[model samples]
Target: MIVHKKPEPTKVPGFWEIPSISFPIHIAKNFAKHVNILPDVEYWSPFLNSKTCNYLRDIFLESMILAPVSINGLMDQSYGIGSKRATGWSLQLSDMLSEFIIPHLNEKFCSAKTSTDWWQENPKKNQAWLPVQVSPLFRFMKYESGGEHYAHYDAGFMYEDGIHRTLKSFVIYLTTNQSGATRFIRNHLEDIDVWDRDHSDWNRRALKEEVLYSFLPQEGSILIFDHRICHDVDVYLGEENLPRIIIRGDIIYQAKSL
Candidate 1:
């Protein structure tokens, strides 16, 4: 005897399954051109629309829990001086962001001499290096009035495969501020004195003349730079009621195999 079988249920995608937003071609070209000229830094204004920025800000403020800054598993105040919250691992968010930016980054870097010479280190003779993804977790940071981050370098995180690591760091500004600009130092890594628990004299070491670049926060804008760059945040001097809000993430790259 033959038995009738029921058809399987169709699966529905989650809320975060919305289509990835594509950056404008002209904006992408501009970003590439500026980065190519600057070599290690680029600030893309209005990368995300005001509505999207508002949505992210609302969600983060409502759902995420902020805590004192933690450094290397400890709540340290010497290095970073602000509150931070992590969105945890979200593959959807990571893929969305990566899809929006990776294509442009890959196209620009893979074809440009600036990337081969300055961005990447010891790349394989002829192998191709590509940006794979943005980090799965996004760190939301809040710097209240009088808060500041000392001079420091962002350390890259290695992927499970060991061949890839976070090559670039990015920050998305959610709120506009008159102060609290991100300052990049011109000194070499060896010459810069990074802030530590015992040594908190980064202010004295980071001279005004050594500042290579300073970017003020703009709502819906993003700043991207090499992970090796020495940078710090100037003291937050904005309104006491409005703190500086930013989302931080990294771009992982598949380096040419050694």
Candidate 2:
């Protein structure tokens, strides 16, 4: 007898979804096995398994306990972004990227061809061709009561060596909290087109735009979106003793040559 599986739902051009897969059990299987660039953002859940999430959370907690509070970081008070007293530990180029992120991007998002074409069409002097890569910076953020992140955009950066565009932002929840959800602002097609331009101040514009969606904290679930999107964290309303914990990182891509 012949049987047929149900057809998947039609995905919006700028949106993609990968359903939940229990951690450590199906973690080896591709969570984003079937994914593509959506109209505005990409949302994938169950990216990290329970064991992996707990392991990283413990490491971050231990690091926070050992490190001294430093006042220097990315969040800008002038723009009203990030937690007022945010504290955490960080690691650049974690091994988890190769184990989890790269595979998903290549197999699911089909970024390989896209990166190659981008570099070929926009070649620069003294630069060498490179594959689409993800450089993950592991960050642990804890927000106390009343902490909030104002509307903002993740800006692209340039360096003496090369430029690094934050193509995607990844957030992994470490703690469950009712408040302090991350919110993103919706944009008109024209607004998105403007943001697509180089050095556009979309984050600043997000302050006055309508909200697209708000993501609540769910342990082990991963939220991914285009860095160009305008987003912020809501004020934490729970008890002072209860802090929201989150793992943050950026999927960086840029053409670099020797």
Candidate 3:
């Protein structure tokens, strides 16, 4: 007698709730757009103006022409990177960050005071209060036709100077595209039992089986989420040569113990 096997469980509708907020003001004009994001994800709309976006996109395109594109993700090239023929290029924007991004982040965004004032005004007698930090690491990502990413979490921030660094992942769309939205899982994949297997294998399976919350990639718009969240870029559904381009960075938080 043959025994009937139990069918695999299907993902439930609205199993994970994705919440978003609008930052029409307060954040810079470039990061002032209506955001579609996962719950707890921080959004700074209008992260870049049209002019800046165009300038950055041109830089990425020129780099692709000058340098050979490298495969992204794990060295194994699995989890949709190799299969979809996706490629990436990286740029170190420390100079840009110091000249432009850092000033804005400290003055207008995270903390509105200069380092001297921030330290002097703090309650700590030793002036040891930790301050906000931004990672110099940045990447310019590109995905052509059928290019995509499987579900995965970003790298965590490294500890620095006896301070625990908690990272917030940032991505800004630089290309005009309506189809290549980023998909984020509602909950952390590490907490789920289904993803207990090998990283590559489980990530690909989670892409198909997990509940996904998606955000449309708007030009100049930025999405920042806690690094532990699982996310991936959806397959490009538009024209072949028209690639989806984005700039990625990380924000590290340093907080004093209460």
Candidate 4:
């Protein structure tokens, strides 16, 4: 007898789900003082091209220097230096990014609520606080040998019926080195023998159906896509042996209440 399994849904990018991982490359370059290029296409193009929007260099540098704080060090990155302490610069940058990107990202992405929604979440109950704002201060996660990330999906919305989802989650790779690469390590098919497809779970099973896209986000380059897709960073042991670093930030859009 033979059996069949359902085909997986195509992991397409969702524009309405999560925050679109894009930078205001165009607005920053042109600096259309008061013109509000917020809705212009010419606005986003220049941001991706280096020579055009180079002012952002200072921002990335500032973020990189400060990301050590929010970074969980060993826990989040799975490996790091002496101690696991968040620095002042880290906190400041997180706050600054949250404030600066609010209006801009809100304008670009299709989120349900704005900054105000953050205050309503009632932190005392959740314990988990969302970034009211985030900036490009995130850096590369370094790990020594035997470093690995357990799997978990970014939380999605759920109704009484257990129906929920987020629009998208975009990751901006400031740079990549060492052993970092988006990898999908699941059995393509079910088993028949030792040579058959013996499915193995690498990082646990928080993320079932997902796609990991390895991106090379230049100084201003960004990787924009869906958030519901389960993802994780691979601990790298690069031959160069340099500390892997990348600066990134995050934001979330909620559904408007009825």
Candidate 5:
């Protein structure tokens, strides 16, 4: 009897293939000067210049069909409405790329004092925290004209030891659009009685009164927030010719003994 073995997965491309552009040091330094539009959320614009953004977008669009696309990491053809509305393409970033971008994100946004304070105040304070790393696995998502994600919270990825996990989530907008704002809610998922009862029964647009903030899509802008925040995407009202495009990933920190 002859048996067939499963095929090995194809290796993803490395980061060096991505075009390297100079970091916008001046813009990043003034990130704090922006008006406090949302609580516990940091927003920075033009993180990548127009040329870089366009190049990245073109690369993704060109290779989207060849890349591994999934819904919440599952290759299942049928997905429930509650999981996500946008189409996600998973891309693996090389260690070299993670090292390249993490320092910019850390020095410009997460200072040593801030990291130390967060570690000390965390409930899992017993474990020593290592420097944060940009997650190797990230999704480049595209939303169509009618696409809309239901209210949901993000889960952290356990990268190293059980104690080391993703503490923050970030979105980098690759394309600008007239609609499809990411809306954050003031209430927690547990606080919403209907959310627990049935996801299909939940109305995505009914939470306007509870909205804490709404971030419109802007090219080359980055938005970082706590992983536990409950948020949803507004219905994409852009023209059929344009789809909302963004990169979503987590910031992971390793834990070690002192």
Candidate 6:
């Protein structure tokens, strides 16, 4: 699928708390061939005004927006666009990853530019409230049918307005298959309600400690969710001998440090 016009915004569930987001993913052949060779996965693109990055970030801070994401590498060179991670249907987050991910954040929010500049965004009375610095961590996993992930959730804030943190998540879909779709275990905002409260029941029983959730990925489908919800990605079991690929990114900023 080829995208020409800017997409229309859809009011999704509470994925917006960390602020979740989702968009109609588009994919086609050969998208992988050219983008796959991108060296320095962290390469910075200086064209700030370019729509490429603007549209990607536009998914969130709608008005005059920007975003930052840490992405994974591409699948085997032989795989096409919807079959690889980097080349999948994802917004170019490297613009934020390299240019704004770290440096811009430091300059914009906290005063921690250098390691020595580790100024506290918020000081906890005790280490118990040390305030976790949650970040946007992303991954690209390939699997089919039974290879899909079950329902799960992430660790959430233990305090209300106290020590809150937004574990925002976004996924980029590359291929379109009737079989590959994202499903939510419970209501969406449940994650947002507990965003600042210590909750882990939404996570998987096996990796309870990791707070990792499963995603049924497609080539260029992007899904963003509240970091604190119970959700899962359904597998893509198309019989046409096609592989699933996705390019994922994490856009994390300090919890209201600015």
Give the top-scoring candidate (TM-score). Answer: 1
Give the Å error, residue 180, model 2: 1.4
- The C-alpha stretches of model 6 lying farther than 4 A from their native spots are 1-93, 96-137, 155-166, 187-219
Q: How does each model score on lDDT?
A: 0.61, 0.49, 0.50, 0.32, 0.55, 0.33
Question: Tens digit of lDDT per residue, candidate 5, span 202-236?
Answer: 33453678877788898878887766566777777
Q: Model 5 — TM-score against the truth?
A: 0.65
lDDT of 6 by residue, 83-188 (tens): 2111112233333333423332221222221111122234542111111222333333333333344444543222234334333344554343456545545433
lDDT of 1 by residue, 147-176 (tens): 667676676666445456676799988899
Per-residue lDDT of 26 in model 2: 26
List all candidate RMSDs to the true structure.
Answer: 10.1, 13.0, 15.7, 15.6, 8.7, 17.2
Q: Which candidate, 5 or 6, has the higher lDDT? A: 5
- The stretch of ten residues in a row with the least summed lDDT in candidate 1 is 9-18
**Candidate 3 lDDT:** 0.50
**Model 5 regions more than 4 Å off:** 1-35, 66-101, 104-131, 188-203, 256-258
Q: Arrange candidates by lDDT, highest first: which order?
A: 1, 5, 3, 2, 6, 4
TM-score, cand. 6: 0.38
* TM-scores vs. true structure, each candidate: 0.71, 0.60, 0.61, 0.38, 0.65, 0.38
Q: What lDDT score goes with residue 76 in model 5?
A: 36
Model 5 lDDT, residue 186, Cα = 57
Candidate 6 least-lDDT 10 residues = 64-73
**Could you tell which candidate, 4 or 6, scores higher by lDDT?**
6
Alpha-carbon error at 69 in model 6, in Å? 22
How many residue pairs in model 6 have overlapping backbones?
27
Off by over 4 Å in 4: 1-132, 135-140, 143-151, 156-170, 183-212, 216-220, 224-227
For residues 1-258, what per-residue lDDT tens digits would candidate 3 score against the true structure?
Answer: 111122222322111111121111123453453434444465665666777677667655654421223234543543334222112212224334324344444211223211111222234423223325445445567677766665666655444243434346778787778777777754433443322422332244234455566777777777766565667776677664777878776665444452
> Looking at candidate 2, what is the lDDT of residue 55?
67
| Predicted candidate 4 versus true structure: per-residue lDDT over 43-77, tens digit per residue | 12113345322333334333343222211222233
